[model samples]
Target: MMSYQQLLDQRAQLEADIAAARAAERRAAIAQIRRLMSEHHIASHEILPRRAARRARLLEGEVLYQDPVSGATWAGRGRPPRWLAGRERELYRVNLESQDSREGR
Candidate 1:
């Protein structure tokens, strides 16, 4: 029969061995994944698609109209806002030249 101290020491050793084994396995798995990715010519973006790319495309157009009261902007892609309702949309059309100059274009 092992003493209490001896059993505790054995448990500690077993835990250390388990941790080492886990680390080795993780390293091997990472290496295997890198090798497979290289062989298949897989890009990181292909695996993890960018939501930012889609959002950027959606917001590609410049601001076409703005509300003078609230300073709200719209790209004129979707339905007109309430501020522009029953109003001439051309009245709120953004001046491209002034906008470009403000942006240091």
Candidate 2:
């Protein structure tokens, strides 16, 4: 038998608690990430592959590419036009040796 004002206040308090909990969780995660980086001898600002921004993303049959500056995920569905530059070919081969070794051909 809560009044309307009491219900609104309860909702507001719950929302604030959720936000505080989220912030605390974020801090904990970042601390763990920092500890792992130190243990692995990785730089603090090391960049990893970006994640997709869509609601339900999958990589099984999707093409992989990154926007160097903004790290936006994009597909490579269509054939490249003749005007595409040749130098871009080398940009996609950053970890060439790992890829070749994986095939073990």
Candidate 3:
């Protein structure tokens, strides 16, 4: 039996209460996370692994092409290097057979 205006006011107050509760809970969570990080001596990098580190690990010793003249290597990812530009990429491909033989494969 509440009036329309009374119900609208109640709704507004409920929304404000919800927002305040969310803010309080977020602050508490952040505080707990900080405490745990401090106690464990955890660095931010350890928690959030770097994409560059993973990329380097994956590309390690994985040269797909080589510039015979300069001996520069590429893993055939991203943009082609200056020496490899405007040329057939297959010409610069590393000799996989030679490489496999050298590795005793």
Scored by TM-score, the top model is 3
Model 1: per-residue lDDT, tens digit, 3-89? 999999999999999999999999999999889999999977786567866566448767889999999988888898888989998
Report the C-alpha lDDT of model 2 over 21-53, residue by residue, as the tens digit: 999999999999889888999973354433432
Q: Can you list the residue pairs that collide in candidate 2?
A: none
TM-score-based ranking, best first? 3, 1, 2
- Which 10-residue window of candidate 2 scores lowest in summed lDDT? 53-62
Q: Please, what are the lDDT tens digits per residue for candidate 3 over residues 1-105? A: 999999999999999999999999999999999999999998878876788665765466667899999999988888999999999999999987797688775
Candidate 1 runs further than 4 Å off: 51-105
lDDT of each: 0.87, 0.59, 0.88
The runs of at least 3 residues in candidate 3 whose Cα sits more than 4 Å from the true structure, single-residue gaps closed, are: 52-105
Badly placed stretches (over 4 Å) of model 2 are 44-46, 49-105
Error of 1 at 50 (Å): 2.9
